[model samples]
Target: MDRSTGSGLSFAKRIYLPRSIGLGIGFMCVAAGLWPLQPQPWVWALLVFNGFLWPHLAYLLARMSKAPFKSERRNLLIDSVFGGFWAAAMQFNALPTVTILAMMAMNNIAAGGGRFFFKGCLSMLLGMLLGLLTFGPAFNPETSMLQLYACLPMLVLYPLALGWVSYRLSIKLAEHKQALRAVSRTDSLTRLYNHGHWKDLLHREFDKCRQGQHRATVALIDVDHFKAINDGHGHLVGDSVLRLLSERLALSLREDDLAGRYGGDEFCVILPNTPAVLAADVMERLRQELAEVRSELAPHLQITLSIGLAGYSPMQLDANHWLKDADQALYQAKRQGRNQVVSAAD
Candidate 1:
């Protein structure tokens, strides 16, 4: 689902269950505590509606609205108002009154933090004032054992539900973070490592080579006459050619090999644990593979690759030196009439 709809659904779910459980139990506490005062039939009816039906009503009111989160926030404030009204109606009987106010405050804080909690408190006061105006100056400072027992279910279970929601949210966030990181690392078209990430791997491979006598070779591959390919067959055909070439290159390389699009029609590869000759051999095999490709873009056209190979050396100043060597060899391959592999001398 889209973010707003999913978020709305989550808000509805958050309210539906615990509110269902807690409010139903809360009504019983208020009912027992308010019994001595002999409230009107309408007051008992409101309590029944708030306890058994308000949760469903609030969920529908939020979920069906254009902006669910905002509607749900308002619903939470309404819950607090109902709590406050019930508190005054029951003559603020100690335990049930404390439980009602505390749970609604927690809901406000969880929904919109401290600022919303203040607003909820204000809503509570408004409800209390209405109750006072309706039935003046009622007070019952004591709580019976039965009333205290009724408050228990709401106090213990709702917080556990809140904790479970928080935990699941954390896991979903972590998965999204991992997916975003993967997108950042990959090239959009070729599905290979992008330039910057491939460069990082090159540097890491260089560092590993410097630590020991591990052999490694880097190659720069250029699609011969790539501009002509694009101009003659259109950019769409040019893109298909690049994708085809990348697929062939992937199939030719070993599992440990790293390949990347190095901008335009140029690609690069780092072959760990391979000598310059072996790297050239692999590229030569890839060259032969390209020779056999029959393009759908132009029936008579066959794409060719020019590759330059360079191996690690003690005399090389840095990773850039290795890259430069590969680049020089690529230039030589291009100059030697294209569609061939050239290796830098040891």
Candidate 2:
């Protein structure tokens, strides 16, 4: 499912398009229905041509173009051009009471759906106030200020209701986007990061450490005699042991530390702003704690770990090279003894 990196509009935008178009169309349809009450035939024709048909056509053109919505510059251009054409269509004909109100409502709905809430609300209010000026005269050429007071209640309620609905929709969309991101980055088991998530974090942290000359460490921890445990006991106990081991690792590390399941029976920890010596000490303490827990939980089988530590240094090497050295040290620790800590050369 992976495509080119930085390739297109973020997934959130992709999901939002259909919802936005549906709302736009719904608002336009509402406007078209109200047209029969308007006194101007030209205004009804304009509403039919622009609010419903023309905007939908523009939306289709953009979809067919396949331009990513993430490009803000291009997106702005498209919105401006299409919006100008829409406004021109509305302004070309003489509008009436019902047509004006419908146009204002449709504009409010479209603007609120897209990221222009304040502008939409202000415009809706202004449009209604202007309706008082135009429609009031139609009823009576010398209509008093008292006459306009009757319409004020309905005018206020209209914008408030639309704003509330728009706000609710926006919040729901945001929650959906957040849930998608969590599912993409998180592992179901152990509740820690998966391989892909860990890799991205590693690269990001490495860049920060390199640029800032900030000390950081990577620790590779392998559960010793893991294959034997799986062979002697069933896979279920093996899985529990792995989860228990990770729980201990999570408890021992700092709040800023990133712990991930590298693969079966192996885990990696990224400790930001911690030097190699301190990272090694931390992992050693964790190893001792893990051994104690294993003794209490699974006395029938023994479990211990070997840890390899490597520090980040911009002057010495890049992120990949540092990780390679740490992995090599991990192999060395496994060769030297089952449960020990090994530090890589700077």
Candidate 3:
């Protein structure tokens, strides 16, 4: 469905429970207020329906509408209109009138913010005029003990219900944000860090090394004859090979190490607090592990990694310079043999 429809569905679901509870409790307040005035039989029946049954009908109306969000907004206006009518119907009893109007205002502002709030206020005014015409204008600002007691449940319970709904919505929003962040930083194929995020991490690591806070090694890894594999077998097999290598890399590295897909067929790793010798050993172990891994898609296929390592050095001018050392060493490894590890400091 479209964005508006999706949002409307969500809005309707979120408002459903609060509306039900609010209207139910509101029935009591209006009933007690009107009991003192002894309203006609039909008026009493309308109050019963509005209090006990209207919330479900309103929810159904929104859910079945072409535009649920807009329907819900209209429903809110109807609620405001009823609130005003009741306030007048009770002859403006101080406690019940204030209670109903205040609750309706809270609901409007929460549902649609300021613009909708003004619209709801206008609807309420219309309702009050209708109420005055129907009941004949009369004033009874007095609030009895019984009226105050009836108003208490709505005053206490409705805000609590609204607050609970707001809290749940905030939590869902936070989870969505976190998932988006992870997706943005990850490689779609390998599930490793993406090129941009990996490079950002390299800059941070380079700065730490430059400040004498830590030592680290950077490695660039390439699959030997990757193009030949894709040409001979197919891109699907090529993808499987890359995924295998990524799984091995994740399994072999320390928790502090970082690995990323630098670009198509090329991977990079950062080993924090590691020297060139130790980084080379780690790469050699990874290379050996992959050499033994057989693809389920192509059982006879052989996988090998040519890796280059560069340890942090005071002589390097910047992060790019450090990366260049690793790149050059990678070139040397491929030059010497297709499947081997080479260290720049060596």
Best by TM-score: 3
What TM value does model 3 have? 0.92
Model 3 stretches astray by more than 4 angstroms: 1-6
| lDDT tens digits by residue: candidate 2, 26-99 | 33433433333353665556445543464455445444455534332233333333333333333322222233
**True-structure lDDT of candidate 2:** 0.62
The TM-score values for the models, in the order shown, are 0.86, 0.57, 0.92
Clashing pairs in 3: none
Candidate 2 at residue 54, lDDT? 49
Please, what are the lDDT tens digits per residue for candidate 1 over residues 248-337? 978888899999998999999999999999898899999999989966877787989999999998778889999999999999999999
| Ranking, TM-score, top scorer first | 3, 1, 2
lDDT of 3 by residue, 202-269 (tens): 99999999999999999999999999999999999999999999999999999999999999899999
Which regions of candidate 2 fall more than 4 Å away from where they truly are?
Answer: 1-151, 295-299, 314-316
Instruction: Compare the candidates by lDDT and give the number of the best one.
Output: 3
Clashing pairs in 1: none
Candidate 1: which stretches are off by over 4 Å?
A: 1-18, 21-32, 35-38, 137-139, 294-300
